[model samples]
Target: MRQMSVRRKRRDRPAEDAAGPQVPDLATKGGRLAILDDTEMARIHEVSVTLLAEFGMSDAPPIVAELVCAAGGRMTEEQRLTFPPDLVARALAGLRRDVALCGRLPEHDMALGDGAVHVGSGGAAPMILNIDSDTYRETTLGDLYDAARLVDALPHVQFFARSVVARDMDTDSLLDINTCYAALAGTTKHVFVSAAFPEHVADIAKMCHIVAGGREAFAARPFLSLNINHVAPPMRFSPDAAEVLVAAARAGLPCMVNTFGQMGASSPVTVAGCLAQSNAETLAGMIVAWLANPDVHAVYGARPMVTDLRSGGMAGGSGEQALLTAAATQLARFLGLPNSTIAGATDSKIPDAQAGYEKALSITMAAHAGANLITQTAGMQAGLMGASMEAYVIDNDMLGAIRRSLAPVEISLDTLCATMIAKTIRSDGHFLGHPQTFDRMKSDFLYPGLADRRSIADWQASGARDIRVQAKELATEILAGHFPQTLAPAVDATLRETFDIRLPVARMTKP
Candidate 1:
């Protein structure tokens, strides 16, 4: 048995110096909810191990099968590669827990597997709600860049995962290269992108290396990671995606092996059954990556989606979806792996009241359940088929509130406030004018930037604009003004000369 030391570093917050009380670090305030007890979690793990040991996964890539076989996995008569319980256990134990998803800037970096939660944009939606026209259209490479910029500007959205697919690209290689380029150009924060083919992974890595100044620097703090869907659900490995996983592991890139199994369709109808199968599949991915390179940073992405039996479509906003995602987070934690799950993907077509409640319920539940990374927390809509810019702006405010909800109650003498209460009673008879009240205002409270909190009369006087309209205005303002200079001029020139970068430079800068 190989001994692996767990790296459990918490997310670093801005230091509090002479500068007034620092804003509380919301990422550190999760893991407060556990839907499954120890016995239930153990039972789920048992089922998953049994599934891998008996049922096994089919269609494993040649390299994956070879590596697994070398690591004690067996090829059955049915041509499925089965992992023994002991091999699965060893793989789980060998996984490096402290995986840092580094950003271009140090402050934007996120430390995973340390019991903290981070929410960011997700989905490779084919369509986007045009900010200028308020209509859904096929997403282009420019839309992907603009969406990344929106996420970069939004304070609450911590990372950028290529939200919309660039549908205008003619070829798979072009799509893969441009998608990665646009994301890197738009945000200095950590980025996640998918590779269409195994060969494209090297080109994307080369692009990242140029952005990071060299190969060694990029490897030390990789600003980009791959979100590989290695499994096709129903106990089968996607050949191309599995090959991409192998390539990513060898390249030393952080990879999130996402296994999205839709219940009642690709997986069993029951939640527990879906979880067990998804867990088995996710473990299989990790085992492959581990065998490829045990030092590779791999995040367990067990995203089990919900299916509405009546409509036979995805129910991304359903309460059942929230429960399943939260339960998956628990399962990941039980195995002590850095994990991510999908939430806030409302089935609503727009960012209306329905979108609000659906996104809030699912996102909040996942956060409380302590998912290390919660994707699709911003900009996803129409059951993850569309990305909305205005929705991203509105979801920022909602995520801020959710993060604040996770903040621990400070019970210090100052917070206890017996002295202040007595002083207020003896003096102004209210704490409204108190110094503590004024001092804690900025530090303790997180005021929404876009949410209208004014009086009804004031709102009416100001034209009584709804949240969607306000969000559109704000998003438009951000898109117009906030063009981040993530890449240096020299690096940009070199990249353009090297790869088929589609996003125009004029669009990345303000005119």
Candidate 2:
């Protein structure tokens, strides 16, 4: 009678308080979310091709114009360079799909063109959330290096792109050189840096060769890549970045031709219109890179940004942004090209609850859509205007959970455990003492380094700190102790002498 009363009490609880039925256990699958069907994708492609052939892109460098004309492209009466459908097809066919983003260490190498997903850090924010003060300040060279070290220590962050601009640099050349050097010094994983001038590309490549042992060795692996914002909004090329693209491609460095168009501002207001324009611009950039060096490794980076129509401000954390990026990933898959896109950039000023939900929603969508490289997944804040060290630690935990959700579940005979279940029923009711349970515990489960899973009483006993406090403590520890020896002492001295490397050696070592 007492048991029956307890059951009735549980059943009569408020719907919100009562636990719902358990979710069905199922195998994980990806690339299933479809915002556009085949016919819609076909229409978008048709529109993109039409935009390229008719409207074309303006402000092409003379060399680019010459190369495109030589390859069946033409200059419009309005001086815009236009690509015929056949020419675009040829360029797409000539794209090198088997590109490898090699890290300094072999275990960190990642092959592109597969549908597998990778998340990493990326941005050029001039400011950083100071770890000590919890206030924003101009990012210095040390800040960039510290961010790189944090990324190196975090397993979920796959690559280290230049996350913050060194505001202390005196010149663009120094900024470019030091940015790449700092990233290389802080992590052995893949590094991506931007060149401010076309001539700077060779100097940066020279530094890479010094670290890589020789020119030939660097060329063989090429752990560093160049990020060139070749296109400026709706069907136009930035002449300087275009020149940098040419230089980087000719220097035998992998180039990610990034085109960011802000919808309702730099691009069309509608999502499809934004995608069409961005796709055309990305194709034009790739064609130019292909012309510069037929064997150049190029990644198709089509990033269509979102804008809040009400205030005309960048809305990177919006649900619309997630949809646009996922659709862009699908388009890249459709073209059979190695591609990348931006996601997980929250507009929040701090890494709060808002940041958490915004990042998870966008990143999950992009990962499921099979974006080969999803940048801006960690440490970014304030609409990509700030980098947060604590956020990297926190986001690492989030990324791990998301990755676990994407892992496949085993359903074979052994995994089914019918015999073990029968034996357990015949003996004890639970499998706590079973050998298989012991064997599978570590293999099948992922324990977060930061997330607290303790019971309520235990959590309170342990001081009940929030995630932010825990993350700050972890970030502080990593920044203080985890300086990677990416270059030998001799190599480091050689680079310091070769370029105006401004990061102090003392900062890179533990005292």
Best by TM-score: 1
Best by lDDT: 1
Clashing pairs in 2: none
**What lDDT does each candidate get?**
0.88, 0.86
Error of 2 at 407 (Å): 1.3
- What C-alpha lDDT, on a 0 to 100 scale, does residue 63 get in candidate 2? 79
lDDT of 1 by residue, 332-398 (tens): 9989999999999899988999999999999999998889999999999999999999999899889
lDDT (Cα, 0-100) at 221 in candidate 2: 95
